[model samples]
Target: MAACIVEPILSSGGVIDPPAGYFAALKRKCEERGMLLIVDEAQTGLCRTGSWYAFERDGIVPDILTLSKTLGAGLPLAAVITTAEIEQAAHDRGYLFFTTHVSDPLVAAVGVTVLDVLQRDGLDTRAAQAGSALRAGLLELQERHECVGDVRGRGLMQGIELVTDRATKQGADRLGSAVTARCFELGLHMNVVQLPGMGGIFRIAPPLTASDEEIRTGLDILDTAIAECVSAAV
Candidate 1:
């Protein structure tokens, strides 16, 4: 295999975060096979996950790390990071890096400013604090709503899975749609996982800079939306 690419948190795949030491083991496997481990931190990087990188939790540094989304801070910018040895090897192999948008001064400045703000404001710590509140609220929802079968994720990125019955763990696809629509109507837009067998998974990744009051408001809105939707269904 050329390389093993993975997201520290499977954001698109129901925001699934593997257990601890998982990535460390995966990295060992990659090393044994003489393949590079490439971590795509598009969603979980740059303080979105309470750390600079989610893979840090596993204590393994990827051979190749790709960052975007958060780095742009709403603008369009991306970066690839690797050790000097790997970069030199690629250069020796005649690899050319060229992109029309590469090194645009305006976006580059924005990326720098984004990093500055994240550090100056301690957004990583903020994300961890806010995430605790988010997770707690979600857990409370799971307690009150039988359809809320699971709540999982870390830092600012969280997910709730709706099920027809918690015991059966059957996906409540239609209920998920209704809850999403209700949340939007209630002034809180939520993203539902579109993949098959995961339609009931709602991705709740609030901004790292979001205030505690904002977080509370969003949770209150979510609670109301879920209650209204579930009651309506009943």
Candidate 2:
């Protein structure tokens, strides 16, 4: 049996370019060891990463892919895309799994609507443009705040990594949590994620319908929150 390889994002800090030759090296390893490469695109799929899928940006394709979150347009749906061979393998095994109420007509309708909006409104192109602006804004913020260790990611799925000491790159989880709470209090909804055994990262993923002004406003609030946290800590 070939081993199953999973690459859960190159970095939790955000969608980076997966390090030069990272995908190629992984593909080579998989081919050599007879392994299957699986990509979990839960957060970076559906134009979130500037491209339809983040893996596409890297010029690498996975044996199997899993998608959810934005697929149902906030409704509840998930799907798996794989090769015909994989589907045939499942059939050969005579394995059948089904959920009684898995197919909700309402949710299916929403999925269709989501796809229409993505195509007609050009959300993917918007994501690419807005993402570039957001990333540039974040890089400027990092320059202003010494506590910011790294600002990385693609399209709308971006993150700001906070560190107490840039030299050591130690995670400032508490500060990140403080910023998140303050943003919420200020009426901006955002998320702060703590990667087990890694540094703290603040995720900035607004709805695809968010306006350019709204994106600027959210980042402004974040900048203020970071400044406030750094000031209070000192």
Candidate 3:
């Protein structure tokens, strides 16, 4: 029997650090059970979380690392990084896979340009700093708006959780959807998430190239939408 474990750092509409002893425990368990640990950094990789890979922040390396999302910078690309041992194991079984249109030169060029821009413009550092500022501002907004229950995330990836009851922390799905629609109407694209076992959380992940002024403008529009929704609900 083979097993795989997928652990992501998402909680309370925020990206909480993984459990204090999660990595150590996972290493021990995986070694004992002979299971593979796969880290999926599709959404959290490519300096989106202030690090080349989010797992780097946890100080643990996975047997298999999957990446996509921003890697191609709007082009279709995905990658799986693994150790030589794993590669040998797969090759020993004579498993060689090839795909059609694996790497279009045009897309590859775009990826190269994206990497250049990210390094030249210091987007990783900018994402960290700008994300911190955005989180702080959202926290202040939460204090001002009863509808805002929590603000959480890191780097360019953040979420604003809307709640109808502060005591119970119940999600206000309609309110969140309304706010997203309002922001879109106000010319700012935003996401309203609907995940199982989670409440209404607004997903805010702007392009890494977005300027500080663009972030502020988007947030201002969001503030207006949130306020308007709260007022209309009363």
Q: Report the lDDT tens digits of candidate 3 across residue range 1-234.
A: 354656445523344456546765776688799988887777877778777776776577889888777878887987778999998998998988788867678877887787788888888898888888788778888988988888877788888888998889998888887888888899988776657645378777788877888888988898899899889888
List model 1 lDDT by residue over 139-161, tens digit each: 99888888899999999999999
Whole-model lDDT, candidate 1?
A: 0.93
Output the lDDT of residue 154, model 3.
75
**Collision pairs in model 1:** none
Decide which is better by TM-score, 1 or 3.
1
Writing each residue's lDDT as its tens digit, candidate 2 over 23-131 gives: 7678778889888888878777888877777777567888999888888877678777899998899899997878965777888788778778888988889999999
lDDT of 3 at 45: 75
RMSD of each: 1.0, 2.2, 2.4
For model 2, give the 10-residue run with minimal summed lDDT. Answer: 7-16
Model 1: CA > 4 A from native: none
Clashes of each: 0, 0, 0
In terms of lDDT, the poorest run of 10 residues in model 1 is 195-204
- Give the runs in model 3 whose Cα sits over 4 Å from its true position: 1-7, 10-17, 196-199
TM-score, candidate 2, is 0.90
